[model samples]
Target: MAAKTYSAQHFVECDQCEENPAQYFCKNCPGQLCKECKTEHKNRKITKNHEITELNTKNEAFFGPLFCTDHKTKQIQCFCVHCKIPLCTECIIESHNGHAIQKLTKAYKEIQDDLQKKKEKIEEDLLPKYAMLLKTENLKQSDFSKQAQEIEKEIKAHTRQLVRIVKQVGKNATEDFQAKLHKGLQRIVDSEVEIQRKIEKLKQTKDLLSAKIETKPTVSSFEPVNERLLDEFEKLPVLPKYHFSKFQPGKIESMIEKNFGKLPILKIDTAKPNEGDSDIDSQEEEVEEEESDSEVPYNLRLVQESRRF
Candidate 1:
């Protein structure tokens, strides 16, 4: 729309007509590369490397210049489909000379057609597979949620039961120890009372014996005490730790095949239509014709691979 303006000292670059034209003509991809720049653009090592589109033309630039690797000066205008490289007419007499050389324009169109077929195939075949994958994942997630919830509930209930058992075991052990403590305390109390009575009798008898005269020795003492009895209560067994299974990552065996095996195709029978449905019949015929014409027969890719003889 708006023309490029330049200062009086310097001239504006023209993209279409000429260097410093009266009016700016058209634009290319990036910052306006002028028409004068086209020669420089084509000659540069990096710019020559790029698929540079001309600003003035509708033709999209693909695969730069298509120059013959053998013939440096020549633009490769013909593609030897057998050799699959661009070749000038002069190269025809060389080793691969006799092979088929289709014009580059036809080759380009043929490639475009092949790519279109591939794109459509991806939509027809792989797209449905992708959608099916999504559907399967969603369904599986729902099922897993339901089942995992049930499993978690079961695990929680079992865990609570185990905890109750552990608590009961602990309570029983504590109560048993307390009962043993009661017996030990009673035994110690009875022993202390017996000793006290013996001491009091000895004190009275000793006072009398001292009043009479002094005698030789005395009786021995007992060994087992309340501390020894409590040691028996201290030797109770300990409770064990709780364990659980972890959730692993991967598709379950049964679920794997259902998601991955195949893309489904629907069966349909074409019925002959009467005069009233002739329009539908014509459309179907046209579609079939287009489909047949548009199919990609075969071609090698840009990448190379080993071929079978």
Candidate 2:
């Protein structure tokens, strides 16, 4: 069997021996060394107490800038809490003198804990409250839309009723004017008939008187005819003067328009905090009375106007 031969495949050769595979890395010396050379490197006065790590152990200190920029030879090992900056021994002593400082590892853990608490607050409390508010606002929006639709329906109904009322008023006015004109004209026609009868009697009387004067040629005949004429004239009826003023549509239109303009405003009536059932019932009764009173005019006026017409 062939003896196992040592080879440096993944790792480099020791910096001192250049023969054996490196087993440890010195952070202060900043180099890899074999076990034999590592012992020798540790015993040296200049390298003694230098931080050393195994080759397999991943150390971030060896991968990046460890020395402070201002103090070229000093390592950056501490974090300044007050200034919120990384610092070395010299930086702490000079610029960040007496400032609250901790080891970088400890500071990093504390910062991570604080960030976790903030994340929990956002996820558990703040975000859920905002979500509830958003939900409430959405519900309010839906309610508002429903209310708007209801108001639109009410407005349409009121407009239709107003139009009906205006039409009825116009029809009533026309019928009333026609009725009054018919009544007046009838009275005039009756008076004219009576006057015509009287005129016929007067014509007969004049013819009789003219015949008497031609036959008798006496003043006594004149006296009898004159008396008859005077009596007939007294019995005759004087013709009546009938006058019908033109219907003023503007006045009726304005009145109907004013009534329509008084339509109630639509609104949401919130329940009173202290109101009881009795109060609510009273309010309902008042509303009923108002509605009944409002309808009275339409009923009574329409009936009365129809009768008059």
Candidate 3:
């Protein structure tokens, strides 16, 4: 082989001489070796049995056995099937005797494949659902503001016909309407925040899995993949339902205050069906007077509780 040049800033030094760039790695010693040192390393009686390999980080790390955490001097040789943990020679004899065991390399490859599947699931399934939910929440926010403005217009138009005393009542009603509007919008806001948080969490998990899968598989990664990742993502966030009260203009009867109608009472009908009808449903609020014969309460149903593409 021809001589290879070395960069002063970025090169691993030979473990034996510490003066020349290394060209090989010994898995037995787990150390770097130069061309001259590699020749001498293979000649010695005791050290001659050491296994030397080309100085490639990925190949060396993957092929070499990992040291046991419990028994520092012993290399991990197998995986305990029942415990779902890597085991060294000492571990097999002392702690995991007679336990089912499998080759470490095989277990490492299986884990790598499992992690790849998890990363793909996040990318292909969970992310799109959250993106759609985010879009729907934004549209609902805009629609709520528009509907509230329309109801305010109805109140203002009716307020013009009442006297000073009735106008005061109208003012109070408008203030109350504003307060309710704030509360409804806040519900939508809270849902949006929750969906956004879930989306970010899924993205981070996807990135982590991708990174771990791309890099060389380690002993930690060889352990069983957490089942919760798939279980938790199977459930998407549930959008909240909102109740909006429509403004009803009271009747201005004779000049006597007693004859003038009282402010409209807002009632919500929980029995109304709002789901399983469509992908996106927009229902308007029904406004009615408290004394009126009609018992139908106001219904402000918007968007399905859950949706599918």
Best by lDDT: 3
Cα deviation of 130 in candidate 2 (Å)?
A: 1.1
Candidate 2 structure, TM-score to reference: 0.36
lDDT of 2 by residue, 63-128 (tens): 323556678887677778787666778898889998988766555445444444444544564445
Candidate 3 runs further than 4 Å off? 1-61, 243-245, 254-309
Q: Taking the tens digit of each residue's C-alpha lDDT, what string does model 3 give over 1-309?
A: 354555534356787887777778887887779889999999999889998888753353544667788999887888898899998889998989999998876666677788888888888888887788789779878977887788777777776777555565456567667776776777678878888888888888887787666544456766677878778767775565444555544446744233323333332222222253343553344434344364332110101111111
Q: Candidate 3's C-alpha lDDT?
A: 0.67
Between prediction 2 and prediction 3, the one with superior TM-score is 3
Error of 1 at 136 (Å): 1.6
TM-score of 3: 0.66
Residues 222-254, model 1: lDDT tens digits: 111122322322222111111112222222243
Ranking by TM-score: 3, 2, 1
* Number of colliding residue pairs in each model: 1, 0, 0
lDDT of each: 0.37, 0.49, 0.67
**Where is model 3 poorest over a 10-residue stretch in terms of lDDT?**
300-309
